[model samples]
Target: MSATTRPSWTWTIEPPDGWLVVPSTATEPADAVRAWESEVVEALLESFLPEGATGPDAPDPDADHVATVRGSLTQTVGSLVTFADEAATEGARAMAGVGLLDRGPVPVLVTVGMGDPDESDDVFMTVLGAKGGNPVSPPSIEYPDLPDGDGIKVSRVDIDEATGGAWVSVAAGRRTEFPDGVVDTALVWRSQDLVLVPTILDAIVDLLPAVKIIRSTV
Candidate 1:
């Protein structure tokens, strides 16, 4: 596809990479970035696979939405990691299909499940990138446009978002050094994206306050 010829599908170009992903974009607010990523993943899943082939067998979806629509959903949530692993598995399969894993673009897999408190600063999240299914070796580094004190801990996970699958990149700077004592939750920020399950949707609806926009019928 040529840049001059805009495809029917939405296309965004990355700085030096081949494609620019929405979740990987730098402008989104940190608070809701992960949620936004989940939303896009769900939509992609819906776009692919047969109606009944999604749900439990598909990528993890938001819990809040699940409860309300579960009864009517064609798919089910087999387990918590269903969504996370599914996304990775799909990405690998895609790379393989195109014969690219070894020589093609590297695959990035992220778990939106739960951020590991051990490595991150908060309970909210910490984004992680796995290349070819393993934690990205030598973690990536992303620098600030202007000289800043410290840069984000990782680099972007570059992957083409395929149906039902998400593309994640590693970034540098989410990690901060602790001299020797326990640190407070205040230390952590959204940059360290943890794996978020579809269950998070329920958390959002129940207590997690967020500005929600409803769709309108034109």
Candidate 2:
């Protein structure tokens, strides 16, 4: 698509207290990877080595431990980079961030992306198909306060694996028409805490209003 016709939108959200939002421009894949890695490493270090744990001066983690943490995160870094790249290619803005759920410090991946107006349905369905499992209707999420369009459709899918047992994936998508064009937004996140689905969904609802469409000057 030409620059003037490209779909553009901005997403802003105030993550819950424990949650962290790793900002991303989606224009550079490498930058996204580095930002995510940096945020995660810091969060991990804080959780593992709480402030003032060792007397008045908290000891810093050794180089070896830091290296090990980065090494372990390498496996997932590529996926995040790919996600950011794809969003950029599709003329969409996206953020690939990590969330700290109630279940310990197990990092949860949260992605918010805005895509071409014409591909709104496809974007929503693609997220729902991420786990290839039956979609469970998410808690009633209505955005009556927002503009009119295909209201958001949210699905909760339970993914089971031989090694990982089971985890819950939530995907929500909405297509809203702006003065320029129809812009779609998708929010997806995975967590092992099934009981927190409602809370997560509520968060998603709170995030939708923050989406602002960028009108192309050309």
Candidate 3:
């Protein structure tokens, strides 16, 4: 699609290298994934309608939406990782998908859920409140211009005590004129080893800039 053509779907970011995709399994986060699938379909179908067109004028986008959502689920479901035990899981799971990175000695679970109808900062607050943790840095970080969207907002916090890892939850999303547009989120974490934090943070920073929006013209 050309730059002028708006994306019918949303966006995705490249996970850091060495981070292998998790294999598909009947896991705890399946419910969250399914919810995301439903949201994606709904959003895509809404996008299919012409600017002012709605109701009968615009053909039902369900068939196309279903096909797209199913394709997305089949392609990415197995790769998702989740940290449900985390205090933020309750909120994070409600917004987007979650997943695990198995490349390091310890598996780092993160919330891969992004592009909820709400702003990233709003989502972050909800997640932080649900998790009930101390602020790691400032409550948020602002990026004036992200790759695809208008701007980006991120909220982060350090989890008080997580198993054997240094845990942090980050909720972020890109901005758009449409209030209903999708925003993204990532819960970043690494082994308690101080040395690993820098590398992990660097990877997270790299991944955020790589996020791309794939628009559907169908």
Candidate 4:
């Protein structure tokens, strides 16, 4: 008898500049190929990183982290997709607010958080995309909160980890935590997320061609 494992990625997309590629590695190339979609899973966001940052996120590429990223992106995309699917969702108008550009559409940003990625003390995440106008606007959809998820009830100093030359280190962080570790009822659970959003938004703007957002008002 033989055992099997799941695939790495499931989607991919190419930008006008070139192909932002993502390959799922495994003994079974066929499984890897089937598991990942060339457009979505291999989203161009991987290519948009601070100069030194790397792709496919090695910080915590384990089963739990992988699932967290997938679930988070899925919820985000799904929520927007729903609005995209329906033209009448309330307050669903895509606003180009708080990004770098002059508020046109928006550079999609995706972030995933998990407890201590790569032995770090903080809950870690990887971001993709730049901002549209302010660069701090809320995501079209937020990631699902894990019930009784591991919470680090402490605050730490923010550090700069820019090793990739040419591009400055946009991805830096310290320990972040709400006053209370209980997330479900905590309003400020993801408060620190505010600081890390622009890098992600920038990545999205650079990589993705156009993000179709439904406008409820229009």
Clashing pairs in 3: 80-99, 81-98, 81-99, 81-100, 82-99, 96-113, 97-113, 115-183
Compared with the true structure, all predictions reach lDDT values of: 0.29, 0.52, 0.43, 0.29
Q: In lDDT terms, how accurate is model 1?
A: 0.29
Model 3 Cα lDDT, one tens digit per residue, 5-85: 654655444545433323221334667656654554444344433453444454565546555645655443322433333
Full candidate order by lDDT, most accurate first: 2, 3, 4, 1
Off by over 4 Å in 4: 1-38, 44-61, 88-218
lDDT of 1 at 6: 33
If ranked by TM-score, best first, what sequence of candidates would result? 2, 3, 4, 1
Off by over 4 Å in 2: 1-36, 54-56, 59-100, 103-144, 147-150, 158-167
lDDT tens digits, residue span 1-218, model 4:
12454212111133333322222222226454345433443352243323323345545435465555555544443343333223223211121112233221122222223232335332242221122222333224233322324221111223234632222123212223333221111111111344544544344333322221111211
The clash number for model 1 is 37
For model 4, what is the alpha-carbon lDDT of residue 19?
22
How close to the true structure is residue 11 of candidate 2, measured as C-alpha lDDT?
51
lDDT of 2 at 81: 51
lDDT of candidate 3? 0.43
For candidate 2, give the lDDT of residue 141: 39
Which candidate number has the best lDDT? 2
Clashes of each: 37, 0, 8, 31
TM-score of candidate 4 to 2 decimals: 0.22
Candidate 2: clashing pairs of residues = none
